[model samples]
Target: MAKPKLPIPVTLLTGYLGSGKTTLINHVLSNQEGYKCAVIVNDIGEVNIDAELIQKTGVVTQKDDNLVPLSNGCICCTLKVDLINQIAELVKSGKFDYILIEASGICEPLPIAQSIAVLEGDEEEGTPAICRLDNIVTVVDALRMATEFGCGDNLLKDDVDEEDIESLVIQQIEFCSTIILNKVDMVNEEQLGRVKAMIKTLQPKAKIIEANYGKVSVGDILNTNLYNFEETAGSAGWAQAYDKDEDERNEHHDHDEDEHEHHHHHDEDKHEHHHHHHHDGEDHSNCDHEHGHCCHHHHHGDDDEEYGIGTFVYHSRRPFNQEKLQEFVNNWPKGVVRAKGILWFSDKDKRDYLYVFEQAGVQITATENGKWLAAFPKSEQKKYFKEYPDIEEHWDEKYGDREIKLVFIGQHMDKPNIIERLDNCLDD
Candidate 1:
C-alpha cells in the first residue's frame, strides 16, 4: 500500500480595508522563499484591483497561470463555493508548492476556514484531498489602529454592502493565527505599544510581527503550521476567559469536595476552620458567571488596566427581551471595543432560533444562527445528550441549552455596570 500524498499547504491572508494586504501579497509572491507559490486574490468587483496592483509590481503577471483572481464578491460569503472549487483545481494541478488566498477586506476569516476544513473528501463536491490550510495571517494597520478602532466607521463600497469597519477589523484579528502589524513606521512607539496590547487582549494566542510597507519575511508568514482548527476557533480572548473560568471553577469544586470529606472525618473537633483562597490582590481571576449572572474578568497586567484595556465574559440562561436588548446594545457603555456571543431572545417567533449578537464600534447586529436544541422534539434532543452528556448539566426544563454567553473586550470596561445593563435586558 502506498502512503497518502500530503496536502499542499495554503496560507490565508485577511485584514481590514487599507491594511496593506496587497503589499504583503506582493512581498510573499515575490520572495517565494524557495517555494513555488500560487496566489488567489478576491476583490469586491469585476475589476480585480488587487491582482492588477500586484501585477504592476512585476512580481506576478496577469497572463501568469499562477495568478487566479476571484472578483465580484467577498470570498467568505457569496464566493465560498467558488473558493472551494478553486482550491480543488489548484491542488489537482500540483504545480505549486504553496497556495496563498487573499480574502476580501470586508470578509470574515471563520467561514473561509470552515470551508477549507469541510473539504477533507467528505462532501459531495469533489474537493481534492491534497490541500491543507497552513495558517491564517491577519494584517493590521498600525497607524490606523488607534484612530479607527472605536470611531464608528463603516466599510462602505459601491460594489459591496456596508459593514461595521470596527467589528470586522476585530473579528479578523480575533480569528487569525499570525498578525502582521503592518505600516508600523507610521506610528510612534507609544501608539504601537497600545495597538499591540489591544491585539493581545483580543487574541492572546496569535503571534505578532511588526512590519513596514507590508514587508515581512516569507518564512514568518508561510508554512508556519500554526493553524489548528479547534485552537484557532476558540483563540479569541473572550473564549479563553470562559475556558479559564471553567477550569478554575472545576478546581474550586474539587477542593470543596475534598474539604467536605475531611470535615466528615473530623466532625468531633469543636474548633472552626475555614479554607480561604487568596488571589494575591488581583480580583480579575474570579469566575462570577453562574445562573446567567456571572462576569468573568481577565487580568492582563498592570499596564493593561492603565491602558484601560480589559476583557469580561457574561453568561446567563435567561432569554433577553428583544426590545430591551436592542436598546442596551444601542446605548452600550463607553470603552466597549467589541462584544460577540450567542444570545437567546424572548420573542415568541425568535425563541426557536439562537441569535449571534455582535457589536463593534457603534454597529450592532443579531443574526439567526440556527434552532436551539430546546426547539427540537425530545427524541431529537436525545442524540445530542448522548454525544455530550454534560449538556444535561446546563439543560433547563423550559430552555434546554439556550443561553446568553457574551464576551466584551475594550478599554476601561465597566464590568459591573455592563452586567447590570445586560441583566436588565433579560426576561424575568
Candidate 2:
C-alpha cells in the first residue's frame, strides 16, 4: 500500500502596523535558499501595497501563482473563512513545499492558529489535509518599542472602531514562538536591552532574534516545526496568570472543605470556628465575594514585581457617564502599559451601543461594537438567554447584559486608585 503524503509546513508572520512585516517578506522572497515558499499577504486596506512592493523587488511577479494577496479585513477575525479557503486552495495545488502567511498587523494569532488546526481535507472533494503549522514569527520595531507602547497615539487615525493597536501589539508578542526584534541599529544598547526585557516579560517562551532592516537567517524562521496549538495557546503570560489564579482558588476551596469536614467530626463548635476562619481568608481587598467578581492580581515573583509588571481585571455592572469616561481616557495613565475591554456608557445616544475601549502607553481608542442584548426586543433577548444560559445568570434587571470589563496590564499600576477613579465615572 502507498504511504500517506506529508502535510506542507506553514509559518505565520505577524507584527504591529509599521513593524516591517513587508520588509521581512521581501527578504525571504529575495533569498529562498533552495525552498519554494508560497506567500500569502494580508492587508487592511483595499490596495495591497505590500504585495506591490514585493513585485517591485523582481523576486516574484504580479502573475506569479505563488503570490496570493488577501485584503479588506484581517485574517484573524473577518477574513478567517477567506483565509481557510485560500489555504485549502494552496494546499490543493501541491506546487510549494512550504507556505508563508503574513497576518495583518492587528490580527490576533490565536484564532488563526486555531482555525488551521481544525482544517481537515476530504479525499472525495479533492482537498487533502496537507498543511501543518510550523511556527509563528512576530516582528517588533526596536526603535518604536518605547514610544509606540507608551504613547497614547491612535493606531488608526480614521477608524475609531479598529482594535487598539497597543493591546494588539502585546497580544501579537505574547502568542508567538519567535520574535524578530528588527531595526536594532536604530536604538542604543540600553534601549535595546529594555525592549528585550519587556518582550521577555510578556512572553518568556518565545526566542528573540535581533535584526537590522528586516534581515535574518532564512533558516531561522522557515520550517522550524515549533508550532504546537495547545502549547502556543497557553504560552501567553496573561493566560498563565489566569490559570494559576484558578488553580490557587481551587486549592484554597479544597483545603477549606477538608478543614470543615475534620472540624465537624470532632465537634460542632470547632466546625463553626473553622468556618469563620475560612471566611476571613476569603475576604481579600481585590475580590468581591458578594458580587462574585475578582480583580486577579497576577504575582510574577519578586524580580518581576521589581519591574512593576502586573495585570488585573476591572469589572462592574454600572454604565459610565460618557463625558467623564472620555476625559479619563484622554488623560490616560502613567505606569499603565495596556488596557482593553468592553464598556457600557450612560449617554442617551450611546446607551444601547456596546463600546470597546483599548489603551496602550499613552494611546487609547474606543469604538461602538454593536447594540446590547437589552436593546433588542424582549423576545429576541430571550432567544439569546436560551442560547447562552450564563448570560441570563449574570443579567441585571436594570442593565441587562451591559457591563464594564477591562483588563489592565502594566508596571507599578495603582490598581485601587485606578478602580476608584473608574467608579467615579460610573453614572450612579
Per-model TM values vs. the true structure:
0.81, 0.66
RMSD of candidate 2 to the truth, in angstroms, is: 10.3
**For candidate 2, which ten residues in a row score worst on lDDT?**
258-267
Candidate 1 global CA lDDT score = 0.75
lDDT of 2: 0.71
RMSD to the true structure for each prediction, in A, is 9.1, 10.3
lDDT of 1 by residue, 1-428 (tens): 23225588889999987899999998887788778788899997889989888778776664767788999998998999999988878777767778899998888998898888765554567755667888999999998886666544444445445555677788899888999999999888778778888898888889999999888888888889998877787777766665665555455643321110110111121211222222112545333334445556766776576687877777776889999987886687988888777777888898878777777776788888678777878787787678766555446665566777787888877888888898889995
**On residues 235-311, what C-alpha lDDT tens digit does candidate 2 reach at each position?**
65544443444445444643321111110001121111111100011223265533424465655444555556666
**How many clashes in each structure?**
5, 6
Task: Evaluate model 2: give its TM-score.
Answer: 0.66
